[model samples]
Target: MIWETLVEPFAAYGFMRRALVGCIAVSLGATPIGVFLLLRRMSLTGDAMAHAILPGAAVGYLIAGLSLTAMTVGGLIAGMAVALFSGFVSRVTPLREDASLAAFYLISLAAGVLIVSIRGSNVDLMHVLFGTVLALDDAALILLCVVASITVIAVALLFRPLVLECADPQFLRTVSGLSAVTHFTFLALAVLNLVGGFHAFGTLMIVGIMILPAAAARFWSVSVGGMIVVAAHIAVSASVAGLLFSYHHSLPSGPAIILAAGVAYALSLVIGPVGGLARQIPSRPRTQL
Candidate 1:
């Protein structure tokens, strides 16, 4: 039973191995960014950026149908542009960061859908919108690994600045001259990771993998480091479980992975140690009226 269920699937298939590797790389790199986004109260930023990539990927589709390089490059360019512009607005303009992101997301998403409808059929649109994880080539795998590694190292280097900025942006702005630099740099890194992740997980569902694990971890841990660790574990678990389920059931690989993550978040909401529903028992007795 074990051999048929676990060993045979990955052992017999090469794509399964690649999918797992890419998912791990994505989980390790993107989950931590989600944690920071949550910490900074910018969780929607991930969604906005994910939507922002749609226009670029659609443009790439318009140029070259189903071309991996074109789509990746286009998505990267679009995601980065939105990230920088939003950061600039947050720093210089009176409008809030979330406001700027929301505006950009709506415009970008509409433009993308319109562009895709211009020359593509519903099948092409579906393919572009929800990418196939099981079809990853060697180049995609390499890019995923490299981006993941760079994100891990960069996050380590920027740990203190990020925490300080998240805790008190005003203080960090006044005390450290690198607050803007730190903020923009982190956003760039996040965009980069999102671009890489969306290539494998699809633009629509990649943010789920990024955000849900971190959300679940919040219910399990109070410390930033602990949350990151827990988030990574949950993400990896979801990836593996989702892949196995997809393999056995012939399901859409990307959604399967994210659905597994959703399950984890749901379970954590009930049973996690820190703030889970199960732990919300009353500690004080009610006074009789």
Candidate 2:
């Protein structure tokens, strides 16, 4: 009975299988980046960067009418531009990094909306925002797989410098000049993941994959490697649960996945192994004699 209820849908349908594969690929690649974003205290920054890619994606839609290559390239350019510009402004001006990022993202969001309005219907815009995970074609799947491969390779190569850069940037600067390089490299990887996710989950929900799983892992693990492993598990679990929920309930897929991640995040908050609510609650100080 359990197997029929839980496993039959995926076994019966090709789309279900593809969706599962897509979500797993995304979880494996994007969740690690999410961990780093959490470590850097840049969760909101990641969100902003997610929005910052929209105008580029919208432009791609305008040019290619949803050509994966065009939109992805556009998103990459926009995301990287915003990240670099925000970093530069923080360094050169009085505006703080968060403030600069906020300003730029808002502008980008408005621009993306306006561009989409000029050429696309509400349906087209919605697809760009919400995605069609079940409808993923071969091209989309291939792109996601490629992005996952690149992300794994990049994280492995940049692990040491990135760890030093995030843990202690000032010390990294004194010890080596790769601080900026490391930072930007990580940002580029993040942008790439977001672009890949834009296909599977859309720009809005993409950040959900990146942040929620990472946040949940923090409750279960202390080490970076451990967190990555746990986060991957959480992400894969959420993706499967969300897809199942969407299928059975006839709900939208992208938001369903994010909501599933939210559920995991909520559970982590209350009962996780780390400083969860259970741990944080006082043990009712022993009564004095």
What Cα-based lDDT does every candidate model obtain? 0.89, 0.90
- Scanning candidate 2 in windows of ten residues, the lowest lDDT window is 280-289
Ten-residue region with minimum lDDT total, candidate 1:
280-289
| Cα lDDT over the full model 2 | 0.90
TM-scores of all predicted structures: 0.92, 0.95
For every candidate, C-alpha RMSD to the true structure in Å: 2.4, 2.0
Off-target runs (Cα >4 Å) in candidate 1 are 87-100, 284-289
lDDT, candidate 1, 1-289, per-residue tens: 9898977888899999988999999999999899998898788988999999999988998899878788888998999898777778889999988888899899998898899999999877776677768888898898889989999999999998998999899999888898988998889888888888877887888889899999999999989999999999999999999999999998988899899999999999999998787877553243332
Model 1 score (lDDT) = 0.89
Q: Residue-wise lDDT of candidate 2 within 1-289, one digit each (tens)?
A: 8887789989999999999999999998999899999999999889899999999999998998978999999999999888887778999999998888889888988999899889989987887888889989999999999999999999999999988888999999999999988988899999999999999888888999999999999999989999999999999999999998888899998899999999999999999989898876664354332
- What C-alpha root-mean-square deviation, in Å, does candidate 2 show against the real structure? 2.0
